[model samples]
Target: MDQHAEATGRTPDDERLVCARCGATADGPRPTWTFSMEDGRRRYFCDSCSREHLRAIEGRLDSSWW
Candidate 1:
């Protein structure tokens, strides 16, 4: 998925969210995904990516720093 696509804050026409870290796709607006606001844009991460980077997330580190 294109990184710029996430910044646009427009959900895909199909309403799926793609992970910023891994390009994984999921039916969005779901509770299982990890959502973050960075650089004033909404970013979503799939469950696997979120679990792998749980500590970095809790530390409030920028995803770019991870």
Candidate 2:
């Protein structure tokens, strides 16, 4: 297993959640924010990106709309 997997106790595939904007993995040091889409798909965002796009997220706008 890779170092990241070892550190997070999850394999790369098991840590599938990634920031929809920046593509940062959920296993990174920064926290991740998750939102459930209307269609029931879960979207994740890194802490930095989450803070940067807080308004749009709270407005219930999709990232594609930004």
User: Per-candidate TM vs. native?
Assistant: 0.80, 0.61
lDDT of 1 by residue, 1-66 (tens): 555668743355766778888877766465778888998988888889999999999999989999
Query: Candidate 2 — worst ten consecutive residues by lDDT sum?
Result: 1-10
* Residue-by-residue lDDT tens digits, candidate 2, 1-66: 454533333356665555656766654434456453534545556778788988988898877776
Regions more than 4 Å wrong, model 2: 1-12, 28-32
Error of 1 at 54 (Å): 0.4
TM-score of 2: 0.61
For each candidate in the order shown, give its overall lDDT on alpha carbons: 0.79, 0.60
Q: RMSD, each candidate, Å?
A: 2.2, 7.0
